[model samples]
Target: MQVALFTILSSLTGGHVRILETAYRYPRRPTFLIPRNYYVKLLNMLDTYYEGRFRDFIENNTVELPPMEITHFYAYPKYIYDAMNRIKGDLSYFDLFYVPHEHIGMMMLLKGVGVKWTALLQLTPVIGALDVDLPMNPIRLMSLNLRLNGMGYIGDKLFEYLIAKAVLSGETVLSVSKSIPYEMRLMGLRARVKVLDPGIGIDEACFSCGDKDIDLVFFGRLRREKGVFDFIRVLNVLRRRMRMRPRALIMGASDDETPRLVKARLRELGLSGLVDVKVNLTRRELLSNLARARVFVYPTRLDSIGLVVIEALAHGIPVITYDIPAMRLNYRTRAVLRVPFRDINSMALVTAKLLSDEEYREGLANEGLRFVRRFDWVNVALREWEELGKIASEESKAPETKVANVIKAISIA
Candidate 1:
């Protein structure tokens, strides 16, 4: 069985890309379709982090697939439509088309082409846009509009429409965490979802016990949705209220102006001496730096699996994060301490306790080390590969029938 993978590649690194890179190491390598321009960027990333695994894939598989240009987020549906139309005749060569993420554009493309496809629902923008937990005030509404380019309402509705259409189209949906399916159902969208066990993984080297001098560390993308501002607020509370001068590290890639905004906020809050910010470190560099951090403070509201959280656990670091659905569902261990969402005071108090009590901190760190062993990358990747093979095998049994039914269902929707 042959499978084609459609994914978005970017310069900014994340858990989604890490999952794809791991899957590429399986015995059955799927043909990857990404934007033509980012091919070299991907190659460079692989060479830097994976020890030239991309070259190994070519040498072992003896296949160099042509690149596809479909990176524009809003215009991707049209781009994929045109690209698939041009290669409609060649689409029959593969048994299945697999998408790493549940991209609405890819759903539209697959519907138009009448193909058997599966998408991993990492996280949906619909949940972020319409979070009832977050009050919808004027400032929040304006921020949403700015992020969605002044079409916040339309974009939310469109996401709902495409997601419903995809579900009705009979495409298999896999979720990285149970929170996503719950969110979808809360939004009144019934989807048949399979939750992947240990949905995210970390390198074996991430497990270590060493001299941890850094008091706090926050990793992942430097964005507001990731609770970067909340991180700062917690720091402010720590200094002013608790009178603790804890050393903090903010390490991640900057996809927008958030880094500059973060710097400005740091200056304003007088945290320039307490906090150090680093951006765009390679995987190896991140792990090296992460090993020295005593506690991981992630206030993220945007992550589905919180891969960095797992990495922190793997590194024997106790974590304090927001009590979001994803965190409550996945990381419910003694190793991870949870505080109320947006509760800076509570987060600060927890951080201070963890820092002051070395015995308690070490206990949590030991628990974290024990819990993270099950999330080995090889095991997670193998399970996903088996699922994909099952998907492909089922499709190959009656390709024409499945394709026709999908197309019919999509048309009716």
Candidate 2:
């Protein structure tokens, strides 16, 4: 069966991109429909980062598919809408379409055209709102509304509407973490959702128990929702109140104004000297740097399954993150120290204790290394392929029979 995968490969560094890349590596490869300039952008990134290892990395990470049939299109909603109209009839040639959460508009368009597709929910706006610590004041509430609505091409209300419709419409919905389905129910929307394991491969080279010079590190997108500011605040507390001069590293990529905002926040907090900001490093460079850190400080409330957390665990570093639903549900072990949500002071204290106590830190790191072995890329890819094959098998059955079989499968699961 043929599959069409829709996503915007804007950056090579995020969890969604990792998932997309893993999908592309599957034996039964899917035809990817991405932004027109993505190929050139990828080439530029490979040349900048991989340098001599470019060919080796490409051959190792990706599989050989049929000759690519490139179709250029912008990522804007209007452009995608126009393009979909032109290609609606052609979409029937494929047995299934796989759309990521970022492209809900494309999923809606595909549904409108009566095509068979699956919705992969990475992170929903409702979950983001629930995880964040916004005040109930009108102004703060309004600001939250604006931020959620501005997160993607569509407004928050429209996004929720589409999500509800996708769930109630009997489409195969896949989530990366159990927290997603739990949060959706909290929002009063319920459906049969399949939760996928965190699909990220940690290179054998990444698992290093070498010298740990850096005290703390935060690696992810530099966004408020991901707790970049919270990370800075934690650093502020660590230095000022805790009286510890910790060498910290902030490594991430951003397409928005978050880098400027992060810089200003660091200066305002008087943390400019203690914290180093590195942007857009390759995976190899990132893990190489991460190996020097004693602790991974991830204050994010936005990730469904924080892939960076898994990476840190693979690198034999203990994680200290916010006690969000996703973290609690997935990492209930001592490998992760979860502070109360938005408690910067407590987070700082924990960081100090972890950094000071080598035996304790090593214990947690060992647990983390043991726990992370289950997240192999080959196993993740196989599970996803099996799920997709099940979905594709139901295509020829009657609608009622398909629904019953899906319900039965969910029950068995």
Candidate 3:
């Protein structure tokens, strides 16, 4: 079965791209659609996965796929219209289209275009607010309310579109979080929904237990949403209350200007000397840093699935994060400690306690290691591929031809 993967909006640091990269091991090659410049950089980043016959790419917005050849297209609903046009005006050649829930516009459009596709759900903040009916943290609730109010008319149309798509598309829905399937159904979704947690590769040999000298560590995008600044504030409070020069490490990829902003904030908080910041480290470098850290702190205000949290757990590092609904619903385990949203004092206290209490920290670390076993990338790839095989078998009539190349449009925002 020939399959194509296209994401209209691609992020160098995003989880969706990483998931696609992991799925590259499947027997049938899948083409990627992304920007040409990013394609090279992304290939270099995935050097470990390069096996000579890597999937091909088509520069962004180029409708190059032959409608008579490819069987199915697994799309992340960023640029659906362009992709549909790429099929040489033959939607039937693409038997199944996979859509992420966040792309409500694309979902609605596909239904109108009379195409076959599945909805891939990632319970983001908007869905959490609309579906789960949980008491959100004050800040997150406020932000959600503001966004909803701001998008009043457009939001209504989008949901109407999703409901229509749900009724029209008799395809299955794939979700990463357990709560998403239930939420989608609650919203009158008619399609079958399956929960498949996207997994990460784990090699115990790659990750090591190093000296726990680093008191606190946070990795991933150095953006405000990831709680980069909030973490710095928490460190300041922890230093004052504990009255010790606690060491902190902050690492991840960021825009050219973000590093300057972060440094300015660090200096303003008098944390420049106490905190060490780095960006764009390779996989080994990131894991190495994770191994050295005693505690992993992620104060992200919003996240569908915190992969970094699991990575920290795999390294047997205790984590402290905000009590967001997604984290509480999906991974509320004894393995990671949670503080109320925006409560820097509580976050600081927990970090200090973990640093002081070795036994308690180790206990949580052990539990984390056990909890993370379920997220092994092998299990993820198998389940995902199994579903793909079933779909391909049903569409065996699809003609065999050279897979389409990838085109990436959006850059880092």
Q: Estimated TM-score per prediction?
A: 0.85, 0.81, 0.75
lDDT tens readout by residue for model 3, 13-110: 54654455445555655544444445555556555323322334333323333222121222322345555666645555554655534555445445
Candidate 1 residue-wise lDDT, 4-37, digit = tens: 7776555535655655656665667777766555
* Span of ten consecutive residues with least summed lDDT in model 2: 66-75
Top candidate, metric TM-score: 1
Q: Model 1, poorest ten-residue lDDT window? A: 125-134
lDDT string for model 2 (1-413, tens) is 78777665445655555655467557776666655455446556666755533334333433222222333211233444555555667667788877756344455445544567776777643334346434464334434544642444224354444344443455666777777776666555455678877645655666776678889998988877778888898899888887889999998877788888888888988889998899878767787889889999998867767888888998889999987777887787899999988789999989999989999999999999899888777777777777776776665422344333433342344
lDDT of 2 at 320: 94
> Candidate 1: which pairs clash?
none
| Ranking according to TM-score, highest score first | 1, 2, 3
Which of the two candidates, 1 or 2, achieves a greater TM-score against the reference?
Answer: 1
Flag the better candidate by lDDT, 2 or 3.
Answer: 2
Alpha-carbon lDDT of model 1: 0.71
Native-structure RMSD, model 2: 7.3
